[model samples]
Target chain A: MARKRPEPVQIVKQRRDAALNGLVHGVPYVQFLGIEFDRRGDELTAVMPFDEKLIGNPMLPALHGGAIAGFLETTAVIGLAWSNLWEEIESGRFDTDELALGHLPRLPKTIDFSVDYLRSGLPRDSYARARVNRSGRRYASVHVEAWQDQRGKLFAQATGHFLMPASKDD
Target chain B: MNPEKLKMAEQFISAVPHCKTLNMKLTNIGDGTAEMSLPYDLRIVGDPETGVVHGGAVSSLMDTCCGAAAMSHPSSPAGTATIDLRIDYMRAATPGQTIVTRAECYHITRSVAFVRAVAMDDDVDRPVATATGAFTVEGK
Candidate 1:
């Protein structure tokens, strides 16, 4: 049987709301990244406002690459947490905080992630988005892109692989 | 030379439940600088096919280096949190190679400290990634 996918625009709206409502907890750093969930569904877009704290090179005044990577990883997690599958994981019926820790069971843990620097992220507000290439019982794959908001410059790109935990009760 | 700075760095990393698995070690410290290394392990691979180190692990290492560098400053003793970090991936590291990072404190102001670091497999020229960061010195 084919699974129904939520509209991209609708998913964006839901994620934005969840972010605003603090559906994802213990993330005081989210505001530091300047990332806001703007839209959601099959694809998710995040907006990061410029902040001096994120500068990597004072000489070039460019956004740091570590900050860019953090933004990308956080975006991917946010998208997954907003997906329909999260409901089942979060339901108290599981009775395990570890299970409710926002990690999807049946997925391989994110053993590794890599980001390639195509260009310097300018010292200005920027945007990032991610698309799920594949989601399975054992792993989920995602591709992400980040761009400067002013000139729309491409700053960095990343691919993430997350291991999904198998359903214990099943 | 204050032991508090190194102790703080050790405490912060140890506090992180996830980082406990990395078993990071603080090997050396000096003026405006600090060094730490993560022992190579199979679990740290980002690409098992290529044996490339995971970016997140690299970032965590970079973050710790910067944080320790900030703590080296005399004015701040309470410790600092990673305000932000930017890393550039240069290439994949060789498999089973201990990754060493050397972070230097460039500037320390009233509330923020600027840091830069390089992660190398064994050769400095052939760096796996380069990073710059800002850390917030807490407790004014």
Candidate 2:
């Protein structure tokens, strides 16, 4: 007699989905912004569907600068959510039910956000990614970049600090 | 006073998608400053536990206000875009309270306009957030 078990990769993917689904569905702002999530292996990306309501200027038809920053910050939260779920899994504390609640305790609180607009964000679909620069017990800092067409020609970039739960991973 | 110009700024801002989504409105524009208001809504809550308005909403309010202020500025006034912005959340806005933002285009150079803003709910003295930003100044 033999028993089948899920592979580590499968588990990670499942957790990522749980976190992403929880975030996209549970968070009111994220849903209000019409943001979606995608995971390529270990990297997390956020995609905001082009909606005219997001435009800041009617003539330029460009996205609101704050919307761009909001996408970056929300992406950072998504990145942190996945990482937090991963950490919980490692510590044998991961819970599927908790994901349904979309509780804020599991999410990071933004302390500050600084954004740089490199180019005008045209009225089109936009993408964003967050790179965790440093993570500590009390806080996590992330560097975020957003682009419309080419990653090199970033429309906007941001750096933010969030108050996160105490992590034992150091 | 350029009442016609301020009307244009308000109209332009009213068309912004995010502004519409947030129900943001241009309240006033004068000299170097512009003001906007965001009425309370449950859809903008950041945390259900705290029920505070999302910081993103506040950020959008400031960005829109700053852009309007830059355009409304008597000097170097024209179309403008955000160059950079830094915001510090002093505290969360009280739930069920409208958030008001006042931004001033304090300085202007050949290509950039410098602006600062404060966001508050009921207490003008106790601001919920403060922001400093630089914006692109296009041809008048």
Top candidate (DockQ): 2
TM-score of chain B of 2: 0.93
DockQ of each: 0.06, 0.75
lDDT of each: 0.64, 0.83
True contacts kept of 1: 0.01
**Which portions of model 1 miss their true places by more than 4 Å?**
A1-41, A44-71, A74-170, B1-12
Model 2, global lDDT: 0.83
lDDT of 1 by residue, A1-170 (tens): 88866457655554445433353332434544556766433345777788766654455566655567767776665665445344542332322344345332322345345566666677677787777788776677777778875436667777777666565655
Largest TM-score belongs to which candidate? 2
lDDT, residue A86, candidate 1: 46
Each candidate's clash count: 22, 2
Look at candidate 2 and tell me the lDDT of residue A167.
Answer: 52
Chain A TM-score for each of the predictions: 0.68, 0.85
